[model samples]
Target chain A: MAQWALAVDLGGTKIEAALVDAAGAVLPGSRFRLPTGGGSSSAELEAGARAVIGAAYAALPPGESLLGVGIGSAGPIDVHRGLVSPLNLPAWRDFPLRALAEEVVPATPVVLRIDGEAIALAEQWVGAARGSDNLLGMVVSTGIGGGLILGGRALAGPTGNAGHIGHVEVGGMNVPCLCGGTGCVEAVASGPATTAWARAQGWAGSTGEDLAASYAAGDAIARAAVQRSGTAVGQAIASATALLDLELVAIGGGFSRVSPDLFGFIREAIARRSPFPFVAKVRVVPSGLSDEGPLIGAAALIHRADYRSEV
Target chain B: MAQWALAVDLGGTKIEAALVDAAGAVLPGSRFRLPTGGGSSSAELEAGARAVIGAAYAALPPGESLLGVGIGSAGPIDVHRGLVSPLNLPAWRDFPLRALAEEVVPATPVVLRIDGEAIALAEQWVGAARGSDNLLGMVVSTGIGGGLILGGRALAGPTGNAGHIGHVEVGGMNVPCLCGGTGCVEAVASGPATTAWARAQGWAGSTGEDLAASYAAGDAIARAAVQRSGTAVGQAIASATALLDLELVAIGGGFSRVSPDLFGFIREAIARRSPFPFVAKVRVVPSGLSDEGPLIGAAALIHRADYRSEV
Candidate 1:
């Protein structure tokens, strides 16, 4: 019998689920998603989660044995308590996500991990970080998040938030972050953050898309904003690499695509700031997986032994 | 026959070797040391290392079988090439310390690791971090250095320099560090750095010991300097905990003992800076091991299975 893992990804704006095989390919017609947002109530979230999970399970192919279920959710997750208190979902404080998912498929094991970790696992499993034993995978959209793969295994810290790179302070910055920290990388490097910085500098950009277009047209303010964001990210990465001795970083999300030379800017910042040869040697590359990365990484929680946590 | 490991610790001013049992205890009367300073040439270092290794071997108790040899050296070491280019030891650049030690005891595996990693392994094995799976051990003496024990194993990155936390920049500081990095923790928190900062501020202290006395006497400049160092350390620890989700930090070395309230200052800074609960909850404790920590940790590379690397 073919083995399949039911992978669920819960984000601020949506809930998605899909069935993935051992080869990392999603099963035909097994993917589903439902809307979830800031205004979503607990009951609404619960219903949305159930609908997505059930829709994906119903599409499971015949003669296939369900291996397990893996869930990747926006964090501040409590892997110890199998609970999630995502910053974006105030109505679902301490939500028992694992138990709720288990109730949908009784007698099957359910694993929950932070979304950033799931993305890193996906990249390591079948994406750009395929051969690297130590890597950092980052998403730089509306919010910045990251995950670490160290010693060829996912580094799920005590609370399953080991790779919270976005929250680490970048030297010389005093910007306040939504995460209640000052000088956070996300405060300076996220898509919205860059756009706002550009707008504040007299640029007429109101969105990341506008900023990207202006940057392509060689607008000075747009270029400065993009460079500032890239520099912040690079500084943060340098500190992480210095502490963890990472080999590479895989970057994705909308802001990272603002300019093709964004990677070059990040690389230059790292070289200029990183003192050690080992830290400066870390390579920054584009994420290998596409939009399906989160689901695949969630599936990896069951499909790949390296991504599994004892908790 | 009882199993024993020959442990060697090479520092800026001296090289020491000792025999350790599987239980992590150093054998009495089996330890020896030799001086090697900046003026010492590679030939002198080789001769000093040979003498220490020979003395430790000769003192090996009867009926004890040598398992292997473990060596811990100052950064930045190249574990891949078994060479050491210690910043403090200018005379030995890319010195093949591992091969030199191996030649002393033919056919026995000689494992080399950064001194900071050896200290961390020692702490995790039998010191303050016992039973904690993820911890950081740091030395805050003449120059700051650190090591990480993650998932109950030593995290020796590709270059054996994963835990070089001293070089990581502390946000908002622009102090020039000896490691060629700006705003590094060591630049602001190391014993010499703090002393220098205090002196520049009109304090009469010329050394860490003098600063400590002045702090004990309630000198304002001295207190500020100590607090500054502790704050920098705490901020750096917050960043490390945020990135790695560490459980505890064991601090040792001379500067950390400058003031008893240094720990309190560090805790306060972490609480003030760490945006996440997991990072703020990390315990800061005194190192369990004494001066022998480096030697015990060096032995751990051979005595403890978890600290052993494939390379």
Candidate 2:
């Protein structure tokens, strides 16, 4: 019998699969990746899920026993029903993800959750927030997403969308977000949004990587854009800290590498604006897992069985 | 071999003590109360704590074993050091609460937490948030205080103050709060603050209860005052729902009962202002454990063994 579970992390840009052992270690030779795009239809999305699972299954020894499947999707998931309808993934409207996985790997239970919560769980179990009871994990990539682990448990509210930090309004920007909120963190500071904001401010940079390069080169517009994103993020974290009394905020994603100076600026902003000293102490740090975060976090679900999972 | 624990709920106006069991049910004839005031010095506060604890102890059988002690104090407490220097407790700075409790009951272990977190814990253990993975417990009394439980654990951040929701900035409020923040929900909506705001607005009410009575008697000014507080609270909750992805906000304390119309107004305001369907689904409800919330929640600290106890 295989002493491992299957973990799938579905992102807006990629799909990752891993066979995670009972100890949360990703088994060697069980990790693979696939591309994801905005143009995919519902059928395409289902097929993508099947292809990844099938490939992972095939790599395993024939007739090996398997644990349940844990799938972490982008956002707006219904954990109870294993439904997903992420705003960025138009094809996944109310998609029965667990049922589809059940069809692919018959009789193995499928546990569905938002990617943000999965990352938080990962952090709580084995990453930056290890040994901490209260943690907030944020993904500041093409868009901002977050999850909370309070009192040693992942907080999945009704519909499994608690910790949707992107939609919480920050001041001074009325830019509309895909989540239908105005003045949200994503509206002002997601990778595309930050780049767009910089472009509108007459910056010549076209990409986040280019923006980062220019920022390292001390370009004025690029620095301002990065600072702006950091400011919004810092303000949001301050508010979150005040509201939730979080111990640390573990931030990850490609866009978060804009500059170390940006994090300094965020700390300054939070100190100046926040009222509560406890909230002010909430550290905003980088994710420890880096590229391996999703896989490790996916594995965390099976490893931390009492925290989540059915049967 | 007895399972009873001594539970203490310390507030600005009163200190209550009760003997509770493993299930958090208060023992008959074991609950007692005492008055507290602002001028209380460290010695006086210690005396007060001793008095209440003494009363509960005296009420119990002399041979009964007291398992432990749990203290739910008003902020701000240093849970790590077991010290309390609450804003409401003026003469209290760096007071060793657990040490003092040890002086009272040397052999018993002591657990210290903010009253807000205790309330949240109470709800999580036996009240409204019993089965919820993500819960926010709010006390809408003299000031708005809160505690959070995400994924079945208390969100006690660094310093053991995880759910300090009062300082969360509510947009458009120009009011200043004791926490030094302007536009805070507490500044605009807390009991004394709301009453003061109403009085400043030409309403002759002397108290929140009086204001509630006036509103019940159809006084326009009183009704408007209540509505204003409700609106601010609703807006804050809406923001919290967006940020935290919370399922239910269980509100308690005297101010919450200002009107039956309060939660209804809050729900309406949230629905009107929420940018997403999920945010609108967030429930605003009264706490199931009202007067007994703190004591019950203090015992939940033992019952919810998933959370590590400082005691």
lDDT of each: 0.87, 0.78
The parts of candidate 1 lying over 4 Å away from their true place are A178-180, A273-275, B178-180, B273-275
Whole-model alpha-carbon lDDT for candidate 2 = 0.78
Clashes of each: 0, 7
Minimum summed lDDT over a 10-residue window in model 1 chain B is located at B174-183
- Which candidate should be chosen as best, given lDDT against the real structure? 1
Per-prediction DockQ comes to: 0.55, 0.32
| Per-model root-mean-square deviation over C-alphas | 1.9, 4.3
- Among residues 3 or more apart in sequence or in different chains, the pairs in candidate 1 whose N, CA or C atoms overlap within 3 Å are none
- Over the stretch B1-311, how does candidate 2's per-residue lDDT look in tens digits? 56787888888877898888877689899998887779777678778888988888777677777777888888878888998877777888778887877778777788888888788888877788778767789999988989876555666666777677777655556676655444668888999988888898899979888998998999888888888888778867876887766778899989999999988878876777444777887788898895898888776655554653332
Question: Model 2's DockQ?
Answer: 0.32
What would you estimate as the lDDT of candidate 1? Answer: 0.87
Error of 1 at A160 (Å): 1.3
lDDT of 2 by residue, A1-311 (tens): 55778888988877888788776777788887877778888788777888988777666666776777888888777788778887777878888887887888787877888888789888777778777777888888888888877656677776677787776655445566554444567778889998998999998879999999999998889989998898878767776788767778888888888777767867876776544678677787887766878777766676675664221
